[model samples]
Target chain A: MAGTDKQQDMLAEGPAIILVEPQLGENIGMVARAMANFGLAELRLVAPRDGWPNEKARASASRADHVIDAATVYETPSEAVADLNFVLATTARPRDNFKPVRGPVEAASDLRSRFAGGQKTGIMFGRERWGLTNEEVALADEIVTFPVNPAFASLNIAQAVLLMSYEWIKTGDQAVTPPEQALAPAQKLHIESLMGYLDNVLDERGYFRTEDKKPKMMENLRALFTRPGFTVEELAVLRGVLTSLEKFSPRNPRGSGAPER
Target chain B: MAGTDKQQDMLAEGPAIILVEPQLGENIGMVARAMANFGLAELRLVAPRDGWPNEKARASASRADHVIDAATVYETPSEAVADLNFVLATTARPRDNFKPVRGPVEAASDLRSRFAGGQKTGIMFGRERWGLTNEEVALADEIVTFPVNPAFASLNIAQAVLLMSYEWIKTGDQAVTPPEQALAPAQKLHIESLMGYLDNVLDERGYFRTEDKKPKMMENLRALFTRPGFTVEELAVLRGVLTSLEKFSPRNPRGSGAPER
Candidate 1:
């Protein structure tokens, strides 16, 4: 169960994302999956060109059944945001209008405040080939755009949704630290003890020659063992290997290669 | 020309995203789209379940035609990332090993620094249903996992790619500002003139009656005009509306209901 809960928290609610004239069902499905990744639900489709409930889209959604099931259909962009008090339209190009424009971060902050004040807000995404029309953009209070590379700014519908959703989740206070480490790491002392045992065995074997250089040789040996920062299990395995090799030493009193004990 | 320039940036070189045994062509295409969104260009597929040259994948890629076009296929994940100096393996469940585990932000930062040092790097994503195997995870220098909800930590393939790609772009030094405004905003004097014209029309219409309430009413009117933070074009539209209403007045000798030349 601890494995399952690693830094995972309950899902959060977010504004509806309305996709207008989306061309592919696969894009629709991927958008749903992207939204779910950031704990967002409530998807709106405004007259998809290929229509809704396509098998290809459903298959592509992977495991996000709830999003696909709860997705709502609308006849127009205005109809999609009819019940919302505020709306933001996503565009790649800056519009020639006076509406306040915001990058994804600012837009996400504004959406968070609006949601906190008990306002129904939604984001409208235009068609895949061409984004929202001027008439459609006029319906929104603000425009949200990505600060993308000027030389290559074409972002698919799902990528756009993912960026916004990621920012929204990041704004909220969630414990982003990895889940409590699954296993307790072995301490330095544990490795030191293992090193001491191995050193004694090596001393008997004449592995450390030149009495004057013994200290430096021991230090080098310790460094090698500590480099990978072995876990307790790894240390145990190394101890087993050493004991087994000592048994086959022929230095043992037993005529056979087994340890006398 | 700017619109066309958008799709032409020499794709920002980043880590190779190797998909090990990806099942569907649709998932592969979506992954390519996600990679392109943030300038990541290298895609290596290892023994895909559905084989190569998938039509579904090509179609789903949308405008990431280049990514899919240059995608390379490999016999295994090891082969895919063999040429890179460093590799990262993604896994949903925590492994019982001593490998350093990083969240997306830290991983992106590390990848950025490594790229700066002229080292080739890559990240491996596992199959659709079950993630990377233990042996495969063992081949990496580090592991990265999303801090998703414990109850539902499953993120589809494309979503995983999107998250990593988003972080990669975010950590870079590129100017993340929106392009220059298409139309420079109107000066304060323009809005002031429009506000003055509207006030005169309202006074003539007897909308601001009680003298004591005039100042408060006027202050409220000014606040309303500035609330949406109108652009110059918006002010022009408001001024046009006021002139149109003043036309039916019989107060104007301009029979055309238009302002005098």
Candidate 2:
């Protein structure tokens, strides 16, 4: 069995990627790489110009060689998407012969629900020169396109695939309930307390000379410290340094006063 | 008498930054930098923090020293806005106390229109620690807040300043106009046509064939040419080489078939 087939069997739910009349082997490789980024393994190629199993495609796949090795090649789009229950076609230019067009987010959400119900879903991408032809687009249930800068909307093939993959991953079941043991950064309250202690120490040492402006001065200090979003361990270290400074300072009643100025 | 004064004088209308009880010199300096980014020069400090004109503040101001030099110091929020006809306070937390509330875009547009009508408008940013005290928020004619990440809305002082400044600049007369006379790239259409001709000639000569699927041999050739969004000049040089290749080929109709290989 091919590596991609093994990967697909292992997954609880994941979508298939279909490339129709993909002219370049490198682009096919890049699409596989993008698919791997979002954990999608199955890749179906329809009538590639360079033939199947090109070395250039393997090299471009990089860490995703498994995806390239397992890619299935077919003579036409119909054969490629024959098994898919739901399919989405991606294109930049709007077609006059339209199906219901959904943005990336909506398409991802619908696909997620469909996958949850144990239905197979696939997304089709067309050639770089001329995107999916009108006939090819008509085969899909829905059309997908990115909300890009209107004047510069010509996206590289891999970039378009990556965006769609990202949205799908975000909407997937695995994303909803993230792992319980996942570590998050220290909370805001802990950082606030550390800042308060540091300001109090500074105040005790006569660092804040102007009494009327001390409140405003402390606020600015808080802003600077809070911006970095320090962790508990980092805050503890900073507090320790402040404590040591207080003990060593000449202003301390127990320490030597203004030595060798 | 300073650079900021000259800038303010040059612009018949400009946005005023009212910083309420700002605590740190560094943050004040950073706020100045943010203001300068959006062409906002006037800075009003209400009870600033390490006292007015601290050396640390000036150092933090970096290239925005003019904003620091031109800043006006006031003791209270009311005192800060007494001279301004329109005042907008920036706050994150919503309060029950009644006041006209506007989001960043609306607030920026309101300020722009007010300025155009010769009304002096000031935007108030509260102290970082507690934000604007309820009493301080009450002092303003309107309140403005940003549409930030709801889960983590704790924006840095300078970041907040930059966002507001960006909106204000975008809405104001200082908006960047689209460039006139769209200039095409150096290479023109003729060069591209030549490159296409070369590609066809190379294909006919079987330059891309290797120990692979001969039927789909054109894929790798398409990949190379698809890249390098080339101009007309580059294509001409490539075409010249193809012409030389055709002349040298032993299969040329006018020449004796000499096996060059």
Candidates in order have lDDT scores of 0.73, 0.65
DockQ of each: 0.14, 0.01
User: By lDDT, who's the top model here?
Assistant: 1
lDDT of 2 by residue, B1-261 (tens): 275445444432366888888888888987776676566778999998789887777876656666788899988876777666556778886665556678776788777766665567788888877788765665566778754323224454665676677567656544433422322212222333453565576666686565355323443332233234233455556665666666566564335564243
Winning candidate number (DockQ):
1
Distance from true location, Cα of A145 in model 1, Å = 1.8
Each model's interface RMSD (Å)? 3.4, 13.0
Candidate 2: residue B158 Cα off by (Å): 1.5
User: How many steric overlaps are in each model, in order?
Assistant: 6, 7
Model 2 RMSD, rounded to 1 decimal? 32.0
Q: Tens-digit lDDT track for model 1 on A100-121? A: 7898877887677666656677
The residue pairs in collision within model 1 are A8-B148, A8-B149, A8-B150, A9-B149, A151-B6, A152-B6
What is candidate 2's TM-score against the reference?
A: 0.35
Stretches off by above 4 angstroms in model 2 are A1-261, B5-13, B173-261
RMSD values, in order shown: 29.7, 32.0
